[model samples]
Target: MIVIFQYLSIILLIFLPMPHYLRESYLASSMLYSLVCSNSMKSLIQYYYDQ
Candidate 1:
């Protein structure tokens, strides 16, 4: 939970200073990174189970 909050705060800090046009792109990239990390963690757990 603390790690998630840290990421959210970091994202907010980055977006707060950007122009409206760039905010959407930054948010989309952040979402993509989060998704990739979640998927990778899921796969790692599955691999451990399969071992």
Candidate 2:
């Protein structure tokens, strides 16, 4: 989807000049945080629907 592509592009831009290890760590943490945020948003929408 567009959102995923945007996320990847942003990551690529940020890491393009960094060392390999730093890039890997940045990507790993960004992915984890995005996953958590997406899940939280999903739960919030579900809660609203259940109300």
Candidate 3:
């Protein structure tokens, strides 16, 4: 999943022509990343509490 995201970032950086769409995609990617990170952290905390 990280690999796919990196490829997407590279492709967007290299081939994107519209400034507005590029900005929108960048924001979308960052939001997705944060959501994934938060989910992982939540699971980690829950595991610790369960121990």
Clashing pairs in 1: none
What is candidate 1's TM-score against the reference?
Answer: 0.70
lDDT of 1 at 42: 95
Off-target runs (Cα >4 Å) in candidate 2 are 1-15
Better by TM-score, candidate 3 or 2: 2
Ranked candidates, highest lDDT first = 3, 2, 1
TM-score of each predicted structure versus truth: 0.70, 0.70, 0.63
The local distance difference test score of each candidate is: 0.77, 0.79, 0.80
Give the alpha carbon lDDT tens digit for every residue of 1-51 in model 2: 646875786778675798879877877877777788889989999999999
Q: Write the per-residue lDDT of candidate 3 for residues 1-51, one digit (tens) a residue.
A: 865776787687668676878678786887788789879989999999999
lDDT of each residue in 1-51, candidate 1, tens digit only = 746865886778675787776777767876777788889989999999999
| Residue 29 alpha-carbon offset, candidate 3, angstroms | 0.4
lDDT (0-100) at residue 49 of candidate 3? 100
lDDT for model 3 comes to 0.80
